[model samples]
Target: MEHTGPDAHPWLVALEQSGLGVAMRQSLLLYPAVEILHIFGFVLLVGSIVGFDLRMLGLAARLPVAPFARHAVPLAMLGFCLAAPMGLLLFATEATSIAANTAFRFKLTCIAIGLLNAAAFHLGPWRSLLQRGEVTMAAKLGAVVSLLAWSGAIIGGRLIAYL
Candidate 1:
């Protein structure tokens, strides 16, 4: 999967050659530290998402959704803030190989779909659920999709090293 010389994508090669990428590859501590941060970020992000999705799916019928979301969403955003930059740095370190990696591609696709699903749910049925104090079918569907997409993302990410 390692693309070199004329076989490699120009932009990816350039990214791998960038100062940040060089540093990431050369530094023993930096890569592991960034990886730990990345893992923590994903844990926070996915944990919050799963908790909220479970609430939407009727796990906590007593507690309100809006209040939970108000707390969870910020944590998810914070997680994203931590994850995204570290993820970029990680990718830069091996842009050529990773961009060609099937698992990496799948993980990226899942992330995109999951984010879109969240955005759509929030913009649409989420508001309805919050305003009416009722869980709509769309809300339930959104929760299911979120769970599947995020799960797929995690699996795909893990498989990247092996695949």
Candidate 2:
């Protein structure tokens, strides 16, 4: 995707034309590294969360489900943190292109939905479930929703670039 519109995305234009942007663009050396790191972050995020969620669903681990849910949060957060800024920088490079793209908007909406879903889980049933000291059908349902939300977010994210 490329930039467009007469207004010329003031933010992106400033970034791309700035010293940092010029330096970033000029460096053929760093782009590949950043891209690879971003992809690695994606793998880590999906792998950690999905693996943890699946384990919580008892689809993988023989042990109890709670630990996976508890322990894997940080790893997933790390991946998300890694990807978020790079994704922003990448988007800033071509904001006008994305502004004209529905799929991009859809992807962001999905991510927001997923995040909100997660917040709901934490603020509601999952909190009580954990405090009660055992996972239940409701907890399992929550896990399933988590898995679906995250999967949706990932699929939508990938679809953004494609569209």
Candidate 3:
């Protein structure tokens, strides 16, 4: 089905018509390259976050949390820098269809939740916990939630093809 009509978001429609988007959709090799980059980016992003979460859950109690965050957070941000633009390009390829997709919506929601959980951790208990060099129950809980949310987003992203 073709995307048209007032129901479709104007920005999405414009994106779908953009030169980059057209190339992404029409060029077989370019599409696959973008997909590969997207996968690699998310792998980096999720892997870094999971490692930090594991630490917060007491898997590496001997390691200091602040130093670890210094490394992990930057890696995660780097992954995001790689993944996000690729993801947006992929979406532009089939904007209207993806916008209407249940899995896509769920994935976005999960990402939002995951980001909020991270923000809550950083703004609240994390500040104090980092200073004192102790892991608190709240930190552990946030870690668990981060794991779940990011995992759900991955699952949802994968399911986008099938569902």
The sequence of per-residue lDDT tens digits that candidate 1 reaches over residues 1-163 is 4466687899999999999989999998999999999999999999999999999999988988889999998998888889889999999998999888899999999999899999999899988987898999999999999999999999998998997
Which has the better lDDT: candidate 1, or candidate 3?
Answer: 1
Q: Whose lDDT is higher: candidate 2's or candidate 3's?
A: 3
Candidate 2 lDDT by residue in tens digits, 53-87: 66657776566556766667778888889977777
RMSD of 2: 2.6
RMSD of each: 1.1, 2.6, 1.4
Note the Cα lDDT for every prediction shown.
0.91, 0.69, 0.90
Q: What is the lDDT of candidate 1?
A: 0.91
TM-score of candidate 1 on Cα atoms, chains taken together:
0.96
TM values, all candidates:
0.96, 0.79, 0.93
Q: Write the per-residue lDDT of candidate 3 for residues 1-163, one digit (tens) a residue.
A: 4465779988888888889879997897999999999999999899999999999999978998898999999999898889889999899888877887899999999899999999999998699797887888899999999999999999999998887
Model 2 vs. true fold: TM: 0.79
Evaluate model 3: give its TM-score.
Answer: 0.93
Which stretches in model 2 have alpha-carbon errors above 4 Å? 7-9
